[model samples]
Target: MRNSTIDLLKVLASQIIVIHHLLLYTPMSPVLQAEWPALLGLIADEGRYMVQIFLVIGGFLAAQSLLGLLGKARDVAVWPLFKKRYLRLAKPFWVAIAVAVLLGWLSSKIAMHSEISDLPTLAQLLAHVFLLHDIVGVEALSAGVWYVAIDLQLYAVLVLIAWASQKTGQLKFLEPAHALLLLASAMALASLWMWNRNAEHDEWAWYFFGAYGLGVVAHWAQRESKIVLSSLLIACVLGIAMWIEWRERLLLTGVTALLLMNSAQIERFVTLIVQGPVRWLGDISYSVFLIHYGVLVFASSVVIALGLTSVAEMLLAFVATWVVSVAAGWVLHRVVDR
Candidate 1:
């Protein structure tokens, strides 16, 4: 059964991210801001941080899959898990990249927007195919692809920790799974306190592991009396990071982690909604994240081609772009993901 609250968060976050990209890539925001300044500005400025919700949710689910509902280590090989993660993330990702590249070529022939990806070179294309574009210094073929690389890296790191804890006699005081989680939490602290503060490591998993680790911890905290200790540790690390530099991402991560730990407490009315459209959107959120940039580029080109300079026309274009992104994502989810 899906947690309604988590599904609600996923649906809401995905929409915020889409709206953020729409405002960022298109010229509709200036006119919209005049009428809805706070709403537009808020979406433009703060919506991108909703990616933290994704990180948290991703980490939580990954842990559940590998570690089981009780947070115990499954007697499974890490390599199989790695392969499964790659296939799942890369399948839809490749489809989205292809869509983006095609749309990018079309956009170049018609109109140019900063958000439109140019036709990528062989090296750039291969880098993206292998999910190494950020490391190889290639410009991304689309927005939000960087998160794909980061998410894969984070999962690989967890797999390594799990494998190491089992293969070695270290952390003998706790069960092997708990020991692995402990190691992850330690690394997450280092990330929040040190590595995350440095922008040089922004492309690496460690940079985002703090929030990801919190999610993993939150999953384990369920039904455990020792969770108070884990909760305090999370609070301290996040609090100290905030004191060093106040980041909205960090604050959101802290709150999201806390909320996820208590997600079962949601009202029954909310759970009913989750089994509906919210759950559908949440299931397809990854597809939406991957392909929305391409849809945005195509929409921007149409707006430019038609000379949509009026606020009313731009508003219509904006709505159409969103609908197209979601509708296309739903189809992609069915064709590629399912």
Candidate 2:
């Protein structure tokens, strides 16, 4: 069952991320930055952090679908779940990479925007194909692909933890499922308090697991009996997380989790306002996220080649890029993702 609220958040977050990338990488952005410095800076810099919304939503849905409430844990087929996740992510992702490689090469022929164009070596291609580009120290072929790899890693860890807990005997102080939940929460807290603070470790799943785990806890909160326990768990970890070192991203994560936990009960008027476009955008969002950068690279390179320098030209270029990227993403979804 598709929750209109989840779809709404997904669409909003994905669009912001798309705009954020355009502001960051388009050759035209620097031209306009002089005129609208604050607007461009906020969208380009602060907007990238909207990704925490995606992480939270992904974790919530994963737990709701795969694990269910602890007392009634779903008997998921572990290997098949992982397989479905990989194939679902890989199909669109590999297609996007191919498009990126083609555009990257074509951009090299036209013009190379310093940040937008990077010709891929064989090693880089291999690294990206295996979703190990970050660990392999190969520059990414597309913007935000690292999140795809990290999402998969986080899902695998959650699945394994749930699966392993089922096999173990109950611990002295807890039921087996409770023990499992405790273990997962501990890892999340450790990540929030320790690994997430280090910029060097951003490539790893542990660095983002806290936000993801909050999503899981939020889904578990839906049942009346579990609400207090789940909310307390969230407060304790995120509270400590804030105490350790405050981050706007962590705060956003908390807000997103709380909203998701109560999304089903949102007032009807709000749904009427957002449901239509949000659902449509949500349907194509994965495609939008995967394919937008490739389109941007090609579009920005064209803008550079044409030597379009005016503020008017930059605005036109930015609008054109947004329209084309969304159109391409919609097509990609229809042709490949379905």
RMSD of each: 2.0, 2.3
- Candidate 1 lDDT over 212-324, as tens digits, reads 99888887785354566867878888889888877779988988887787776654767877776778998888899889999889888888888888888988989989999
**Candidate 1, after superposition: displacement of residue 68 in Å?**
2.1
lDDT of 1 at 97: 95
lDDT of each candidate versus the true structure: 0.84, 0.82
Model 2: CA > 4 A from native? 69-75, 116-118, 169-177, 267-269
Residue 261 in candidate 1, Cα distance off native in Å = 0.6
Model 1 spans > 4 angstroms off: 69-73, 168-173, 223-229, 267-269
Q: Could you give candidate 2's per-residue lDDT for residues 208-298 as a string of tens digits? A: 9998888877876774447666766777778888898988789889888888887777746447856666677889999999999989988
How does candidate 2 fare on TM-score? 0.92
Query: Roughly what TM-score does model 1 have, to 2 decimal places?
Result: 0.94
Q: Can you give the TM-score per candidate against the true fold? A: 0.94, 0.92
